[model samples]
Target: MRTEFNWHLTAWKSLGRPSPGDIIWETELLNHSELVMRKRAYQNSTLYATFPRDPCDSYVHCGGNGNSVLNSSLICQCLKRFVPGSLENWNLKDFLKGCVRRKPFSCRNDGFAKYLQLKLLDTTHNWINKSKNLVECMAKCLSNCSCSAYTDIDVRGRGSSSAIWFE
Candidate 1:
């Protein structure tokens, strides 16, 4: 008489937040029987075998709080993909150079056009428009070499002020 031995595979399961820098490589198997096999690896060369985990039981968290600087950094990365020479450390001088290169007569009355409205810190304002004469304003700055950057004045909300600056 011959006896047959049955070998049962161990079912893998996971619950909880994924470790930092853990990347899922592949999902080899999944079934309605609540059995699954997932291959994952961490940044530090550690391997993990994960299985079906309860979605409600696991907490997916994103790193880093949303801040202006962080947001700017992300935007810079996006810009780099399109504009190869664009730098994240753009200062007033760099910005002015770029503007001049793109539109040399931007400072002239016919050069600068209405860009758009920008709302910041709960204040709403049109960045450029005809009433304030954006073209003339920019033209004046261009005439004076000392001006590096120019921003429109706030017209809406609590503190409305029209102003220009040079550096």
Candidate 2:
């Protein structure tokens, strides 16, 4: 069943639009179980809906860890929505490369604290829920000259949050 589903997903992905059968099957799958319905949330929130081309092959293999699937899907959706043009044209690999790049700096007062509020304004308006804690952490990072970038450590659960500092 998983292989068949994957084949259909890949075919639909290649076509750039869901076929009637795909739609029917998807609707049936979503209607059959709550878990499937929850999975559909990831599909509905996808930014690839607007794209007219196939995403990178990696897209199909998303949600490796059960805990991070939802967040991973959300991130993938954001990538598809914010970056203009087809996935083929977008330099997703490079974008992530830049994010992970480390620059020399001093973390004079660097330390990890729990429940630190941070805010990440989804410029693309992709992530529906605004994370105040994420926003504040981002603000803190921006205010500090030594901070390179901030990312969440825990993406699961309602109040999950964490940040990474580069020096």
Candidate 3:
């Protein structure tokens, strides 16, 4: 026997996703009563998930260790050499807690790894250099004993931009 469980859109929205999320509405939805949608109607069945779009677009949606790469098979994977911070939660598909490094950073022994097209992490605690090229960025980041990561950017939102992070 198949058990039916119903989840209301309002209940999901109450969790802080203020918008309707990334859903594609059927053409017929145009004819549906606006009150049904405005009233938190999941019963319309005229909407469906648009997987090309995503719901985890906020900063650090997958916590600190998991990166939210749009269109990837796994939006929340454990970082290299790391493990989920809570395997139980991961198994339960609750990826919010993200992952954790298996080994802590050892300043003198650590090295940087680079990937293409990855966005910068949280910036409230980082320093930005709008004119530094990639080579110069690395030299400066490596020269700093506390630097953990560096990336190309123009935090000023103009001109050249690069950044280094503190572990």
Candidate with the greatest TM-score versus the true structure: 3
lDDT of 3 by residue, 63-90 (tens): 7767776587666766676688888987
- Please list the residue runs of candidate 3 whose C-alpha ends up more than 4 Å from where it truly belongs after superposition: 1-53, 69-74, 154-159
Q: What TM-score, over all chains together, does every model reach? A: 0.24, 0.22, 0.58
Error of 2 at 142 (Å): 0.6
For 1-167, candidate 2 gives per-residue lDDT tens digits of 12234212322433565633222122223211111111234346322232213333222322211011233433332221123223442235222311211222345654333333333322221222245466666667767666545656456755446453534
Q: Which pairs clash inside model 3?
A: 130-160, 153-161, 154-161
Our model 1 lands, by Cα RMSD against the true structure, at 21.1
Q: What is the lDDT of residue 68 in candidate 1?
A: 18
Candidate 1 stretches greater than 4 Å from native:
1-73, 77-133, 157-161
Better of 1 and 2 by lDDT: 2
Instruction: Score candidate 1 by TM-score against the native.
Output: 0.24
User: Worst ten-residue run, lDDT, model 3?
Assistant: 26-35
How well is each residue in 1-167 modelled by candidate 1, as lDDT tens digits? 11243322432343564333334344332221223333334334333544445331111111111111224433212111122122433332122112113323333343322324322211122233334444566656567654544545545542233334443
lDDT of 3: 0.62
Clashing pairs in 1: 107-138, 107-139
Residue 104: error of model 1 in Å? Answer: 13
All models, RMSD in angstroms: 21.1, 15.3, 13.2
